[model samples]
Target: MSEPHVHASHPDIARRPRRAEGQLRKVIEMTEAGRNCLDIAQQLQAVESAVAGAKRTPVQDHLDHCLEHAVGAMSRDQRQSIDAFKAITKYL
Candidate 1:
């Protein structure tokens, strides 16, 4: 049997990490400039949230496209669905 085709629409998922990189640079600069700790913390939180969102996007896409499509077949086998779910849960 051939492998199922994966969806390719989550292109912006990769871009989110690049945004986090810039946010990190800003956090570093804020630290060096003796900015308020609260300001720095907020930016750090933004970066963390962005990174999490980046991680989640592909998983969401996988569930929406891949798992949704695979379920019809794996509903019989079950193992593949469970394994795929366990793998994706790390992002949670």
Candidate 2:
């Protein structure tokens, strides 16, 4: 079996989602308490933005580290696959 590859630790990456989770919990509580519509909407937007940032960070890190490091060495098939993945992540 192949060994697993280890990436560098990114504390900031973990922080984004943890903060978003707290924001989400607060939004839930606000909803339960019948908070103002505008306030709830604003908080919900912030949560969504935080979640998106959390996702984007790791993907960007992977591209910056894993894929970039391998660019000159990868086979044509591997390059194509990575390019396809990069294109698809645009929707994220």
Candidate 3:
């Protein structure tokens, strides 16, 4: 198999999900310990926000670098696919 492609923002973006994972573990622990609902909800929200930030980092990097820097060399079909990807990532 070919090597996997890594984005330029990989290192920075990777930290986010790890933070979210840690937040998630805390949330799970809080739940098991019968912590206040609101506190657990708050930690869950933190996890969600961390995950969203992680997701946005790479999408923003793609727009800033991949599409912006490589657009001129891409064929029309390739451009269309990139457009489609941009449309899809907006929901991230």
Each model's lDDT:
0.81, 0.83, 0.87
Which of the predicted structures, 1 or 2, would earn the higher lDDT when compared with the native?
A: 2
Model 3: lDDT of residue 80: 85
Per-residue lDDT tens digits for candidate 1, residues 57-79, read: 77777776766666555554666
Question: What ranking emerges by TM-score with the best candidate at the front?
Answer: 3, 1, 2
Candidate 1 regions exceeding 4 Å error are: 1-8, 73-91
- In order of listing, the candidates' clash counts read 0, 0, 0
Candidates' TM-scores? 0.70, 0.69, 0.71
In candidate 3, clashing pairs total 0
- Candidate 1 lands at a TM-score of 0.70
Comparing 2 with 3 on TM-score, the higher-scoring candidate is 3
Best by lDDT: 3
71, model 2: CA deviation in Å? Answer: 1.1
Best by TM-score: 3
True-structure RMSD, every candidate: 5.2, 4.3, 4.3
Weakest 10 consecutive residues of candidate 1 by summed lDDT: 68-77
| Model 2 poorest ten-residue lDDT run | 4-13
Rank by lDDT (best first): 3, 2, 1
lDDT tens per residue, model 3, 34-79: 9999999999999999999988888778786767776667778778
lDDT of 3 at 56: 89
